[model samples]
Target: MNVSRCDLLRWQFDFTWSLFDYHLERLQPADFLWEPAALCWTVRPDATGTWVPDWAETELDPVPVPTIGWLSWHIGW
Candidate 1:
């Protein structure tokens, strides 16, 4: 069966929204802001009044770890 382009898009959107909604529903307030690492990026402001990743100030030798808070904003946006 050949599915129309619009049907495919709607299916994709529904699937994605279902998965996103499932995760969001399961996420707790504390878990949403949990930082698993010492240098995980979050929504907290820094000394410069900027909400930057905790690893933002660190050298770029290693990639910065993103926290749940960061991921939520990043994914939503």
Candidate 2:
């Protein structure tokens, strides 16, 4: 009945990722790229032509919504 701090953190992390994986299984390609609004963050090519997140485009005032691709990348990596 005793859990170390590291053990607790690991359990929480695992559970969170499990939930993420579950939902990820249900995502479609269109769902992954869906942008509810303009200026939202999502995955795209960087200046170097490597695929990267568009987090730099985000602003805090309006709290821009993130696309599923961005959420997936954020949680998966």
Candidate 3:
């Protein structure tokens, strides 16, 4: 199945979140708790042990943005 751009992004975020949840809990949740406006999700009883990342508002991520130039190959003629 083809996933859209937003779905792709959601998958990425959810995947990372799931990994973190593994360390905190032994069992998986029953379903995916999606927060549409926040663009994130939460599993039932997943990672409630520690202070989780706030999905309510966009936090200042330390992640570096990709470097792109105007003449990059991505720019099609």
Candidate 4:
């Protein structure tokens, strides 16, 4: 597989991934949030104030950090 990733400034691409603006770059972990869709919906802020899992508030949590790494790798690491 041949892939390449780029880290663009947030100001230039705010939530572009969610909108499918471009697939050439991977958004940083702090660039977005993660809204939980369980029995009761909740909003938790990620590194960049994007709603993510509440547990992500800790450094050793299994939420944003891991998910972001996975997304980054999938986007070409």
Candidate 5:
């Protein structure tokens, strides 16, 4: 009963996506930009009106909590 590497990878991918889909389906529009804390990182529109994620050249002492939108953009980035 040996599973091929490809099969194992596919299974892993499917499982991961299922978990993501579960949360994704439950997300509300407001959840995307909801700041859970006073100090948090999120996406904001630039002067040109293009949305961008808050980022730092170097990691800060306290990593900022990311909003759902930031997390999503991060995953895609």
Candidate 6:
């Protein structure tokens, strides 16, 4: 059986999306903003009421862990 390159790529994408969906389905609304550590990155509503993720112009020595909301925003961004 021969699989085209497109077919392989499609399968991989589907598999990855399924894995993401599996975990996403289990997440509660609160989980998106839950901070697992004291020094963590998350999204905050700005003065304009738009949600913004924590960011830095330069990398920090200790990387801040991202909240699920931040990660999701990053993935989509």
Which residue runs of candidate 2 sit more than 4 Å off their true CA positions? 47-49, 57-59
Q: Could you tell me how far off, in angstroms, the CA of residue 67 lies in candidate 1 after the best superposition?
A: 1.2
Every candidate's lDDT: 0.73, 0.86, 0.40, 0.41, 0.89, 0.89
The regions of model 5 sitting more than 4 angstroms off are: 1-18
lDDT of 1 by residue, 49-70 (tens): 9765443545665566777778
The reply for model 6, stretches above 4 Å from the true place, is 1-16
Poorest 10 consecutive residues by lDDT, candidate 1: 52-61
TM-score-better candidate, 2 vs 4: 2
Candidate that would win on TM-score: 2
Task: List the candidates ranked by TM-score, beginning with the highest.
Answer: 2, 6, 5, 1, 3, 4
Cα lDDT tens digits for candidate 2, 1-77: 99999999999989999999888878788998899998687898778998788765545887778998998889878
lDDT of 4 by residue, 1-77 (tens): 53344444553355755444364255654444343322322335578986443333345422333343334334332
Reference-based TM-score of each model = 0.56, 0.76, 0.29, 0.19, 0.71, 0.72
The total number of steric clashes, by the backbone 3 Å criterion, in model 6 comes to: 0
Given candidate 3, what's the lDDT at residue 7?
95
* Error of model 5, residue 12, in angstroms: 6.5
Error of 4 at 47 (Å): 25
Q: Please give the lDDT score at residue 27 for candidate 3.
A: 30
Residues 23-68 of candidate 6: C-alpha lDDT, one tens digit per residue: 8889998999999998899999999999999999999769999999
Q: What 10-residue stretch in candidate 3 is worst by lDDT?
A: 68-77
Q: Give one digit per residue, the lDDT tens place, for model 3 in 1-77.
A: 88899999988878866764564355333222324333333322336564233333555455322212111111211
